[model samples]
Target: MSMIKTIKSLPMAVAAAAVLAALPMPEGTPIFGEQTAFAQRAESNKKQSTRKVQALTADFHKKLQKAQEAIDAKNYAEGMEILDDALARKANDYERAVAWQLKAQVFYEQDDVRGTISAYEKILQFADSIPEALEIGIIYNLGQLYYSEEDFDKALEYIQRWQNRVDPTLISVSNLQFIANLHYVRNEFEECLKYIYQAIEIGNSLETVEVKESWYSIALSSHWELGQYEKVRDVLEILLINWPKPRYWTQLAGIYQELGDEQTSYSLTEAAYKQGFLDDNETQLVNVAQIQLARSAPIKCAWILEKAFKENRVEKSPKNEKILGQCYMMAYEYEKALEPLSKAAAGDEDGDLWFQIGQVQMQLGHYKDALDSFASVIKAFEKDKSEKAKEKTLSATMQRGQAFTELKRFKEAREAFKTAKRMATDRRDKRMVTQWESYLKAEEAREEMLNG
Candidate 1:
């Protein structure tokens, strides 16, 4: 997340200070004759001390200049050695800052992030002696440094210091975003929201400011974690307008669904689906279709499923095909339901899809076709010994008996009902099968009476 890098030359201190300092200390001889030699000695010592300070000051500059050159030449170790000596000899705060600034540059050039941070922070110790611009840079670097170390509180502290010192007009979008990120990384969401919004607001105003997608997403995530759905809605609208990806559209629809606004959610997803943004993603396609089903728009739901099925976009798995068939059935389009149901039943070994196909055909008064589908269900389960499969086989046998009765084939119907009764294991299924057999017997007796 860090982007800050490289270095700027330390603001030069006036080199002429060496010349002025090199001048002899003000001459002072004692007025007392008794202490004249002692006075001379004191004066000599004072002058010597002054010269020593001047030499230190000059030597510090010379070393600082060489260190800066080494840094410029990309010789960080050499630059650091000279800077260490410069730091040792600095005669005042200004000289110390010069050495510290060079040290920071050397560390930064060596790609030692932590060491660079130390050097920059050390420069701030003499803030009174540094230019305002350089001081602001140091403060900003402290924020960047602590942010790199994941010490968010100190990062924010330094960033806030920089913000307080500088004019509001001087604060850039990148700076605000960095401050916002520090708050975000620390889980201080509310504080994060404040700076990020301003960053976005500022970024929106300037063509040069590239407001990245992360800025908006961070806002969205914070709002979501806070359970501030309305804010989430607002940010999503802006995101949809700015960078309209399918995930964003899907999430926006989901937000509406969370609010119990199913119709709106379905409409939004339908719109994206129609615009082709959701096509490549099967889950998104199914989501859009499911939303319609949830909204009671079964006809529209069926149309979407059928169209995707036709385009081979939605998988033709039995599960998917059954859903398509169910959508048509829910819309009262039984004939339309049969096509996908037939395909679903074709390769299905468990017989569940075949049962559904049988029911739809029976509803459409296709008794023979219904009987055939029901037979497929029983045949599929005959080899399976699972109790669940036995129950399904029994149910299919009963359904087939009904289809035979529908076709007026009384003998076949009666035999089918008896088989179903024999196969029934559950008492409820056995009772139901017995009831159907009694009805078949009564119908056979009536037919015999009519023939006689």
Candidate 2:
């Protein structure tokens, strides 16, 4: 929070006055008298003010020289104390202002934010003109303080005020970076986009590569937050065309994902990963695979999933394994589906995953395996800890019994239906179980009679 040390106040006032006068004033406005009145008054009241200030400034300069001598002599604290006293005794407003500004610098060296802010405010009140640099410096500190205190409106007020005063043409790369961060912290996404774009514009005029690349990321992210997906796409296209970084590809993939274009998302992400854009994080890769599943490109989805799974580079959590299983099943690769599906089913006490696994196995003519999976589900809910689980478990068991019957294991199917009929407490469940059991028994009797 160091104060603006070299204000160049005289030049700033002259520039501001020139800009103001150049504007079309009223038809009869006299510029010279109107502007000079305030300047004249300040001069009159302090006729010897300049001389007094100069003398005081020389004294402070001498003290500062001695303080530097002490510092060079390895007496740090004593040097600081002497400098503090010199600041306290300044003779007039202008001289006093510089003293406070200098004190702020000293305090900043010691990391004393409280002293720094206090001294900065005194300088702001007494300085001749608020230089653009000084305005930016002080307002930036005020914005930070207000933000820390949770006073967002005040924070926004000062930051925007400072931004308005800064010359766009003179905004260096570092200044633009600072401005970008301030807008981001305020969550003014639109404003962030505007200034960041301005930075890009300036960088392009100067042919500055670093700032231009930075603006691409800033523009992409801000547009993403605003749900302006098309703008993000456009910015990414330009970035790819010009700079062609890995981030451009990854961001393009993310934008396509938002646009519900999963194939493009997958292609872009794959390109990024191949080109080494996406890091070991693999977040973009995961998103692309997931979106492919959503788009029903199951073979491609499974291919991506299997690559990540086999590499052990990314942890294959059970949920992701389940997705891979579903993809494989959709791709008609049932044998590959079985391993991940089985792991997902057995890894948790989830009735739905178990049901899905059983249904897939049944479709593949693995009736015995299907029956076992569903049987485990039924046993898991036998005590009926959750009513919802109980109903699901019963339904799955009934379906498994039907699957067994299709395999001509009629005796086991009959026993399963009988057990379920006895266990069912809800009237609807009881009725369903009774009907199924009766049908099974009738079928068995027909088989026996035919044999006889």
Candidate 3:
């Protein structure tokens, strides 16, 4: 299961908007090596001079460069023919690696995934013969190719190699964020966090939201999986500030709930509701009401739930009706509570809804209505085997006794109390039933004396 539940339906934070941030260096300066590669450049220049004296090998190199240019010009057949001629001659591994790299580019341009992969792998096999800069470039592009094909394992493997080779300052924050996303897809959340936070820091310094969504998503999910609720909230807050979407708001409030901070959760959901972000979502609307109810604001809870139900914004299911009924009862709106409570109880077999209805009726001084609700509770309990289920039965029978006593029905009150005693599931409950019976007997004697 994904630790961040809300991300699944949202836009996937792929590396779609990635852009490499680089220095405005001299044209030939390698991205990973500024002046650090000067010795390698000098040695390469010496190699060029050495190759220039050998006419045949020099011709092979020039033909390979022409092939690359041909491929770039969309002349694939010409490029392949030149490359075949160049390869038919005896060539060094370095020259062959360059030829394969160009071949891969042509195949990629034609959307030949298998050919691109094969060519790239062939180039990597000459790893020792390839220049350091070209090696890093090849590994990075390999990661990109595998990622494009959704082969995340190979993509991550090559990307990690590229990351290992580069100067951290040279690679774009977007690339780092992409690596983080790969880790996220693979469920290596801890490593995902390491790279994503680096990406976020770089992105913050650069002041770009281009891949910020992806960075924050990976961060949020990673922190959540690590059980770092506060960090999860931090990422969510960043996303909410920049994005301000309903989903982020809900996720932010949900993280608050996970942290056991209902006050913050309730306030945050209320904020979303006030901003009209949650008005159209039934689950969000219900969440808002639940938060309000938790905070002892049942009037607001009932108002939101009742209006949503009436406006057809939310479904009027039995479970929802029960919640609505409870909201009304908590708000002391017994008359309004009765309708949904009755509807809920009518459809429920566990008797919990009936117990709720009886509580509401008893509070409203409706003794007969309360008695009927308790009867339903008892009948439901008759078929239930668990002692936990029987708990409600004991409470309902005792309530029935109270209802009978209130209606001045002494014989029925004694009978109800006797049933309560028989239904009790434990010594503690049995003692409570015994006390109710004693109280009922005293009331009976007092009533008989008064009548005499």
Clashing pairs in 3: none
Per residue, candidate 2 scores C-alpha lDDT tens digits across 187-224 of 77888887787777776677544555656777777887
* Inter-residue clash pairs, candidate 2: none
Candidate 3: list runs displaced more than 4 Å: 1-86, 89-95, 125-131, 149-153, 207-211, 355-375, 384-452
Evaluated with TM-score, which candidate comes out highest? 1
What TM-score, to 2 decimals, does candidate 3 have? 0.68
Q: Which stretches of candidate 2 lie over 4 Å from their true place?
A: 1-61, 71-74, 84-98, 129-177, 208-212, 238-248, 260-263, 273-279, 282-286, 290-297, 314-316, 352-356, 359-367, 380-452
User: What's model 3's overall lDDT?
Assistant: 0.73
Better of 1 and 3 by lDDT: 3
lDDT winner between candidates 2 and 3: 3
Question: Tens digits of per-residue lDDT for model 1 on 193-264?
Answer: 999999999888988878889999999999998999988989999899999888888899889989888778
Which stretches of candidate 1 lie above 4 Å from their native place?
1-56, 88-91, 127-133, 160-173, 200-214, 242-245, 294-299, 310-312, 331-336, 342-354, 363-394, 403-415, 422-452
| C-alpha RMSD (angstroms) for model 1 | 11.9
| Model 1 whole-model lDDT (C-alpha atoms) | 0.72
